[model samples]
Target: MEENIRRNKIVGSRRFSNYFWTIFLFIGGFSFLLAGLSTYLKINLLPFANPTQLAFIPQGLVMIFYGTLSLSFSIYILLTLFWDIGSGYNEYNKLENLVKIVRKGFPGKNREILLTYPLNSIKSIGIKISEGLNPKRIVYLCLKDERKIPLTPVQQPNSISILEEEASDLAKFLDLKLENL
Candidate 1:
């Protein structure tokens, strides 16, 4: 039966887009910072642009502000990537009659977020789909307590058919109803 089958899905946050953005931001921020510094120091810091001739009162100052903001944001994203936040696994164990969802969060008291629910508490498996500019296809676990906990990771949306099939399989394994929302 489907119930006897074990499923453990691993989710990761180290995507190509994440890496691309981090590098892009860093380079852009650093270039801006150097240009601003060149104006203040009266020295050519960047090989491509000569910012030393620019007035520091407005032009240089604006560059510095934008650079700082971008740099700070890039650092934040880098930290999240380094920590591998949101990377974890979902384990559905029929022998233990439990569904475990574990994920890594920011460093602190709740760095490791672990959630466990009894198999009986799962009322149904749900699939939510939205098409358009920001398309989203997600699978959720509908519990008896009316909580719709997402079982899928936050990433690029999966195709509708694949998502539906996964939801159906999960529903059958748990012997619960399937709801498409």
Candidate 2:
């Protein structure tokens, strides 16, 4: 058996209208909604105002609430995008019998969840089953014992049967128990 195997990498699509575009779209929709509401009422609520100086307390409160919520959500989206793109790392291979997986740094390496031990760590693997354009289905190689190493692969166009095969193969390779579900 091979002791170490270099990983074959998979790169996500590089599209202009990906995460950045989505965040922009979210901000656009939020602005449109707020502007439409203000236009319908014919009021200038572009900026926040003190409660006592406001004309209508309820209306002002609603505007402030929605504005805060929208801004917070937009910021969250930005952070998520940055984390995904800036700190993202792809699996080197479909399956690799390695002691550890290390993430280097941005544009070169990133953070990694690794599988350090060959045996006596895994508890069970749960495969997601679904249908859609972008379904969230993958095998989570969970460990029941101590946290020796933590590694999970996020597979696309995922199917349970396929993940089952993969998990079974891995289980046998590691001589670990195969609890398919």
C-alpha TM-score for every candidate = 0.93, 0.49
Top candidate on TM-score is 1
Worst 10 residues of 2 by lDDT: 85-94
What C-alpha lDDT values do all the predictions have?
A: 0.87, 0.48
What is the per-residue lDDT of model 1 for residues 17-134, given as tens digits with 9 covering 90 to 100? 8888888998999999999989999999999889999999899999999898888888988888899989988878788888999999999999999999999998889889988999
Which candidate ranks first by lDDT, i.e. highest?
Answer: 1
Reference-based TM-score, model 2: 0.49
What are the runs in model 2 whose C-alpha is more than 4 Å off?
Answer: 1-3, 6-25, 28-55, 85-98, 101-115, 118-138, 142-157, 172-175
lDDT of 2 by residue, 74-132 (tens): 66655545545323232323254333444322233434433354334556544545567
TM-score (C-alpha, index-matched) for candidate 1 = 0.93
Q: For candidate 2, list the clashing residue pairs, or say none.
A: 7-92, 8-92, 8-93, 105-109
